[model samples]
Target: MTAWIILPVSLSTFSITGIWIVYAMAVMNHHVCPVENWVYNDSCSDDTAKHGYPKSCCTLNDVPLISKCGTYPPESCLFSLIGNLGAFMVVLICVLRYSQVLEQSHRSWVNTTALIAGCTNAAGLIIVGNFQVDYAKSLHYIGAGVAFPAGLLFVCLQCVLTYHIAATTLDLWMAHVRVTLSALALISLVFSGIFFIHDSFLLQHLAAVCEWIFVIDILIFYGTFAYEFGGISRDTIVTAIQHASSRACKSPGSSSTSTHLHCNPEGITMI
Candidate 1:
């Protein structure tokens, strides 16, 4: 059985799930989108009539996933930033320790992509949150504009890594699949970039679609972690092959007699 990947995986999962929960909370709370239409003042001008809105909406995003469904948007500063920050801390710790997982496989890409996305998302939020600008085109909006795409790119990178793990049929083909799937993310990102640069709605749509895809990607990646950490009984053919290869290399008269390795639980060994 492989060493436990439980701690880090669990922590990261909880962190992400918390954010999701917050989004759900925001959506259901006021029953109307908090930002569909509004005036320059912190008030919505004839909001319901103007936007044909039902008059209320909000989300927990806890920050990021706020219901696009309108303007006194319910903000969950508590969960949005503080909770996610705490979660990010846990995830960062795990990534630091487990970053080198799958030394012989493509796990490094997953780890790197995750680190980039999570760190950038959290950091970007921190900066935006502190800007004291809550209006449209405010510093927060600009920050989000920058951070969102970076996060998406890293997320696409994550999807690639996840696909690699999922399609790993005892060969390197999995990595190729990962790369291929990630290309879509890349394309979406590029289009989003072009749209944003030109200030087009096409970018917005692409981002929305990609956000859902990224979420799905996260879930798939979660399954990989679950197998790696929670379900110790499962073993990938790749890991087995690597193990066999290692044993073969360690045979008497081989050149590796001077080297020894111990299973380190904290180390997320991909191979």
Candidate 2:
């Protein structure tokens, strides 16, 4: 069987790395402002002077300036593509793993809710990546609007689910850590949103910083899934093999004694 624990860890790592790599590429190409500049713009142009603050301040809007990193076209396509696709895959796998965990723990409601939130987040990421801020402002903002809150909610639900399972199925300390990270992610997202609504340059910069914090926290939160992936993968594989064997033994024309040896009284495979 494959070492499934590597799946989530790989996806999370790729998502985080993709974002930073895109940011770096944008900065190198002068498509976006350097981190030190603090200014947020599609081109990092000094056009924010009219707002009374130096061009060093970041821009405040419903969508983050990072989404604009790919506005420069062909060269930046990889940036957006990697970020969007990586994030989508990460969330998709995360949702599946969480659902399995919840199902095993007998928390069906939480599993459903978390799956919905994770799917929403994944969809939002697709929108955000496809619609560059400079190309389609409305769509970009809409995507950002959906992604931010939904992502936070996903983390929150997962945190609750983790807490519930910690006593019986998971490590207590890991659950606590996940809960704390989820809380911090939500708080940072809220502050980021609040600051984005203000006109002050400093507030906007702070908002950008908070947004980064939220993203980082989310990546870390997802990384926690690494602990259970292997067990889940093993169980799933074993279950499949057992089911297959039971079917083979019960096939038509098979001897009753043979079927009795392979099948259980409950009509279920005992793996």
On TM-score, the candidate that comes out on top is 2
Question: After best superposition, candidate 1 residue 12: deviation in angstroms?
Answer: 6.1
Give the residue spans of candidate 1 off by over 4 A. Answer: 1-4, 7-16, 30-53, 56-75, 78-83, 86-94, 97-118, 128-168, 171-177, 191-207, 215-271
Q: Which candidate wins on lDDT?
A: 2
Task: Please give the range of 10 consecutive residues that has the lowest summed lDDT in model 1.
Answer: 58-67
Give me the overall lDDT of model 1: 0.45
Question: Candidate 2 — worst ten consecutive residues by lDDT sum?
Answer: 49-58
lDDT of 2: 0.69
The per-model lDDT (C-alpha) reads 0.45, 0.69
Candidate 2: tens digits of C-alpha lDDT, residues 63-173: 234665565655358756765776667665755565456446643566677777877877887888887777788998898898888878888887777766665544778
